[model samples]
Target: MHVYADPFWLPKQGNTEEEYEDACCPRKVTERASCSFRCAVADGATETSFSGLWAGLLVQAFGSGRLTSKRRQETLRSLQGRWLSQVSAHPLPWFAEEKARCGAFSSLLGLELGEASICGGGRWWRACAVGDSCLVQMRGDAILSSFPIRDSRAFNNRPLLLSSNPGRNKEATTMWTSRGGTWESEDAFYLMTDALACWFLTEAEKGQQPWRRLRDPQTGDGTFAELIAELRRNGRMRNDDVTLLRVTVD
Candidate 1:
C-alpha cells in the first residue's frame, strides 16, 4: 500500500516561528508492499510532567512498527516502565513540587491493513482525558464514529492508561480496537487535535465543507493545503497548535 502522508506543525500565531516544535518522526518500518500506516503525536507543552515527551515517546515506540496483540501489550509496558524508572531514580523535584498548570496533549494513530483500519490505541487508547481531542471516521459523505471526549467531568487531566502514573503500572491500556471489518473503497478517516477538529467541523456545518469540498477534483490543490487555508483564514485555530492527520483508503 502506498501511504499518502502529510504532516503540518505550526505554533500559535504571534509567537516567533521557533516557538513551535514537533517530535513526530513519520516512518515506514516494513518492506511489505501490501501494508502502510499513518501515525502522529502532539505533546502538550504544559503538564505536571512532560505530557508531550511521553506522548512523543509512546508514539515513536509503537507507531512506526508492526505489532501482534502480544507485542503491542509488551511495548506499552516497556515504555511505561522506562519512563517511570527514569523519573523516580532522578526525580525532577522542580516539576513535582510545583503544581504547574498545563493541559494534556493527545496522541492518535491509524493503521490500514488492506481495507480495515485500527485507530488510536498506543497505551491508554480508551482511557479518560480532560481535553476534547476527537477521532472521526467517514465512509464517503457520512460520519461513522467520533470518539467521545469528556470535558465536563472532574477527571479532565487524567489519561486512561494501565497506571495513571508510570511508576505505579508499567502496563498501559490499549486504546485502539477494530470495529470489525474493512473500510469500503470510498471510506476515509480523520483524527485531529481538539482545536483543529472543532474548527473543521464547524466550517463543515456552515456548508463550507473544508473536507467535503476539498474532495473536488477540479481545484487540485490537495487535502493538506486546502485545510491549512481554512485554518489560516478563520481564527478558529489560533489558540493552540493545529495538527491534522487524514487517511483515505481508495
Candidate 2:
C-alpha cells in the first residue's frame, strides 16, 4: 500500500511554538508505496515543566519502534534516566531542582500500518495507547473505529500519563491498550491529542461527520493554525495544545 502522513499542530493560546508541549514523529510527507509505516503522537501534561521533552522522547521512541508491549517497561526505565539526566545536566535553584525531581509526564498514542496477515487481507493497522491521546480510522466519509477512547464524555482533566518517575508509571502497562483493524484504499487515519479528540467525538455524537472538515484543515485562509484559532474563538474546542497527525492509505 501507499501512504502519506501530514501533521498539524498549534500551541495553546498565549503560548509560543517553542512552548508547545505536544509532539509527533517521523515528519515529512511523501506519497509512496511501502510495506509498513509508523506514526505516533504525544501530549505533554501542561502542569509540568519540561514535559515537552518527555513527550518528544516518547513519540520518537515509538516511531523508532524502540518502545513496544514486550519491552515497554525496560524502554521507559531507560528513557526515565535519560529525561532526568538531561534536565539536571544544567544548574538549577533548589525549587527548580525539586520540580525536576518531580519529573515530567505525558500521554502517548502510536500506530503501525502494514499488510494484513489473514487470508485475502489487503491492509491492517495496530495501535497502542496510554492515556487520552487517540487514534481514529476513517473509511471515506464515516469513521470506522476509534481506539483507547470512543465516547466524548470519557474525556476528563485527569488522564493516565507516563512520567519520568517510574513509580508514577507502575500502572502504565495496565492503562495501556491495543487495537487493530483492516483498511481499504483511500482510507484515512487520524492521531490527535485529547482536546481535539474530544471535539471530534462530540461532533460525531451530533452526527456532524467531523471527518469532512478534517480531510483538509487547510481550508479558509489556507492554514491549520488559523483553523484551530477559529475553533478556539468560537468556543467550539477546548483551549489546549492541539496536535494531529493525519495519514492516507492508498
Candidate 3:
C-alpha cells in the first residue's frame, strides 16, 4: 500500500507563528509512497511553562516507539527529567520558575500504520490518545471511525493531559485509550488538534464531510490559513493553535 501524509497548521489569529505551541512528529511532509510509519501530535496547554518543548518531546518519544506500555511511566519520568534539565539551562524569572515547578501539560495522540499479514494481507492502523486530539478514518465520502472523543459536545476547554511532572501524573499510562482497525486502499485518516477537531466534529454532526475540504490536493499552508481565517472571521471555529495531519492509504 502507498501512504501519503501531509500536515497543515496555523497559530491563533493574534499570536505570532513562533508562539504556536502545538507540535507533531515526522515533522516533514510525506509524499505518496510504500512504507510503514508512525506519527503523533501534541497540543501544549497555554498556561503551562515550556509547554511547547514538552509537547515536542512527547510526540518524538511516541513516534519513535519509546513510549510503550511496558516503559510508559519510566519513559515519562525520563522525559520529565529532560524537560527540567532543559529549563534549568536557561535563566528564568521567579514566576516562570513557579510555573515550572507546577509542570507543563499537553494532550497527545499517537498513530502507527503498516501492512498487517495477520489480517489477510491488508493495511492496518493503531492509535492511542490522551485527550481531545483526535483520529478519524474515512472511506470515500463516509467517516468509518472516530476515536477517543467522538462527539463535538464532548470537547471542552479542559481535557485530561500528560504532565511534565511525573510525580503528579500517577495515572499517565492508564489515562490513554487505544484502538486499531484495518483500512482499504483508498481510506484516509486524519489527526487533528483540538480547535480544528471541534470544528470537524461539529461539521460532521451537521451531516457534512469536512474531510473533503481537507483532502483537496490544493490544500496547503496558504489554503489552511485562508480557511481558518474565514472560520475565525465568521466565528465558526475558536481561535487557537490549529493543526491537521492527513494520511491516505492507497
Residues 79-132, candidate 3: write the lDDT tens digits: 999999999898899998988999999999999888865334667888989988
Best by TM-score: 3
Residue 76 lDDT in model 2? 91
Candidate ranking under lDDT, highest first, comes to 2, 3, 1
Give the backbone clash total of model 2: 0
Candidate numbers, best TM-score first, in rank order: 3, 2, 1
For all candidates in order, the CA lDDT equals 0.47, 0.87, 0.87
TM-scores for every candidate against the unseen true structure: 0.60, 0.94, 0.95
44-66, model 1: which lDDT tens digit per residue?
44333545555566557645562
After TM-score superposition, the amount by which residue 117's alpha carbon in candidate 1 deviates from its true location, in angstroms, is 14
Local accuracy of candidate 2 as per-residue lDDT tens digits, 1-250: 7888888888999999899999998655657567788889999998887999999999999988888788888999889988988998999999888887778989999999986533345688899998899899998777899998999999999988889888777575487889988888889999999999999999999989887777864532346777788889999899999988888887
Query: CA lDDT of 206 in candidate 3?
Result: 98
